[model samples]
Target: MLQLIIRRLLQAIPVLFLIATATFFLIHLAPGGPFHQERPLSPQVLEALNAHYGLNDPWIVQYGRYLNHLLHGELGPSYGHPGHTVNELIAQSLPVSIELGLWAWVFSLIVGIPLGVWAAEKQHRWFDRVCSTVSTLGLCLPTFVLGPLLMLGLAVGLGIGNVCGWGSWEDRLLPVLTLGLVHAAYVLRLTRGGMLEVLNQDFIRTARAKGLSGWTVLFKHALRGGLLSVVAFAGPQLSALVTGSFVVETIFHIPGLGRHFVQAAFNRDYTLILGTTLLYGALIIVMNLMADLMQAWLNPRLRVSML
Candidate 1:
């Protein structure tokens, strides 16, 4: 397991490099600089600003300099926002994003897994049909549409919570619900499918033959076997959840890395933009590695051979 983990970490270097390269060039590819909005500066002053940020250097030289900073755990300074470092911006905002993500995942699991179990156990009945229809609707509804409608219904119409601003935990509810519901729908479908397959297995038949109660068989046997697939689904679903929340965060006025990423792109804050991109990439990679470890643990053959 240690060797496997080490190998995965080592492999992330090239992936991070690609992410950094793509991010750096992609931001520059867009027209104009971060100062494009500022009152036009004298050419001498502009040159001085460029020199200050090392924008005066060639692209290769700049990339090398960025990589050096990255190696030393520096994310460089905020381009236009003086007296602020990229690390500080990230540090302040990351907790918000992570908080939102953790709540979203927990909510999805709490609701989705049970919903899946109910649907799977009640397959072809009204309960199953209702859950299927609801999950389908959730899958179809994009966050851009759902976020506003939820705000209108919960916050606007009922006055349950404020519709905008991240003032407190109350302010986070709508965004969390909007983000979690979508992923919950995905998990429901995956879990239902896995459960259905597991329920048909010979072990399930033997358990029933032993005269075990339906509840025990369903929960202990069917669900336990089905969990492998559920955990596998979680890795990619979580990555999607984290990435998709960018739109949700923007709409809900949440101060998170997603909003920062959007603002950095608009301002062409090259280092900040690249830093966020690499960070997001690393997150996805880490989730994938966790998935691999989980699969190995659940499957004895994989545990013995792969890990």
Candidate 2:
């Protein structure tokens, strides 16, 4: 396991490098500079600014310089927000996003897994149909639409929670439900499919024939194999959650990395854009690696194959 983890970490290096390289060149190729404004700066001032920030350098030179700084753990300064480094901005906002993501993730798991299990157990029943319909609606409704609708019903119409803003627990309710419900729908489908497949297997029949209690056959004998799909989906989902949803965060007025990323793109804050992109890329790789490890641990055959 240790060797496998080390190997995966070693493999992430080039993946991250490729992501950085692509993001760097693509952002640079886009129209407008970080300093571009409605009233253009005088050529003299623009030249001074360009030289100061090394924007005057060749693209290749800038790439090399950026990589060197990255190696030294320096993300450079944000152009749009004066007096802030990309690193500092990320440090301040990432925690908020992570906290929000964790809540949403937990909510999805707690709500989704049980519903899926019950649906699979009661296939072709009224309860199963209801769960199916709810999951379908959850999947079909995009976050952009679901977020406001939830705000309207729960916050505006019902007066159950605040319309927006972060801090209070009430502020968290809408955002978490909005973000979590969609993923919960996905989890429900995956779990139901996995459990249904597992329950139909010959091993399940044999377990029942051996006089095992229905609950024991379902929980002890079936659950481990049935949950494999959920385990596989968890890694990337968790990474995406922790990164924050751009629309969800923006709608709720939550200060998160996603909102900052959107702002960085609009302002052409090259360093901030690059910093956030790299952070996201790294998180994805790490999370996926962890998921693979978890999957291998859950399945002995997979572990042997990995070795």
The global C-alpha lDDT for each of the candidates, from Candidate 1 onward, is: 0.86, 0.91
Report the C-alpha lDDT of model 2 over 203-240, residue by residue, as the tens digit: 99999999999899989888888889998998889999
Deviation in Å, model 1, residue 299 alpha carbon:
2.5
Question: Residue pairs in steric clash, candidate 1?
Answer: none
RMSD of each: 2.1, 1.2
User: How many backbone overlaps does candidate 1 show?
Assistant: 0
Tens-digit lDDT track for model 1 on 1-307? 8999999999999999888988888788898986666678888887888888888688889889998999999999998578899999888888788888888988988899999988999999999999999999999999999999999999989988777788787798999999999889988988898899999999999999999999999988888677788888888666656643679888988878887777888888888888788888988899988987888877677788875
Which ranges in model 2 have alpha carbons more than 4 Å from their true place? Answer: none
Model 1 vs. true fold: TM: 0.92
Residue-level lDDT for 95 in candidate 2: 95
Error of 1 at 176 (Å): 1.0
